[model samples]
Target: MQLNLTGHHIEITDSLRNYVDEKMERIERHFDKVTNTHVILTVENVRHKAEATVNMRGNNIFAESTEDNMYAAIDSLTDKLDRQVKKHKEKITDHHQKESIPLVDTEEE
Candidate 1:
């Protein structure tokens, strides 16, 4: 999957970028259909915010977290995104199962 990292008011360092990339890579094991990911990091006052947008087959999952550290924020955001992805996948699987299964009827004459 393609990962795009952007910063708002802060300059993104190599280590920071690498850290974000690594963290995002962990989510790939959960769903391999991820096309691309957009990550935005912003530092405002005492709050560091990290937001990530994951593009899946026909769905878009987004998660944002704010913390005192950029890495921590990214971690939290990714955790949230993982949960969202899992939930979405489960829903899709359930729907497909229900749709594919045909009801059987038994009649007595």
Candidate 2:
């Protein structure tokens, strides 16, 4: 998966980037169909906000979070994304049973 990380009103450091990368791995591990991901991190006063949009084979999922710490925000954001991805995966996969042929008796008079 390709991750496009961006920061708003804050400078993204190496540690922050690494942390985001590590968290994203959790999502990719479950659903490998992910084609691209865009992440935005922002700080407003005392609130740390994180949001992400994931692009898959034929769908897009978005989620956001806010917390006192950036890491926590990222964690929450990933958790939301994970649930969405799992739901999407289930939707794409078929789980219904196939029909079997039935025997029939034919009589002509």
- Backbone clash count, each prediction separately: 0, 0
Q: Each candidate's lDDT (Cα)?
A: 0.90, 0.95
**Tens-place lDDT digits, model 2, residues 1-109:** 9999999999999999999999999999999989999999999999999999999998999999999999999999999999999999999899998897677766687
The candidate scoring highest on lDDT is 2
Residue pairs clashing in model 2 are none
lDDT score at residue 47, model 1, on the 0-100 scale: 98
Prediction 1 global C-alpha lDDT: 0.90
Q: Positional deviation of 38 in candidate 1, in angstroms? A: 0.3
**RMSD for each model, in Å, please?**
4.7, 4.4
On a 0 to 100 scale, what is the lDDT of residue 6 in model 1? 96
Off by over 4 Å in 2: 99-109
Tens-digit per-residue lDDT, 1-109, candidate 1: 9999999999999999999888888788888889999999999998999998999997999999999998889889999999988888887774543445547765677
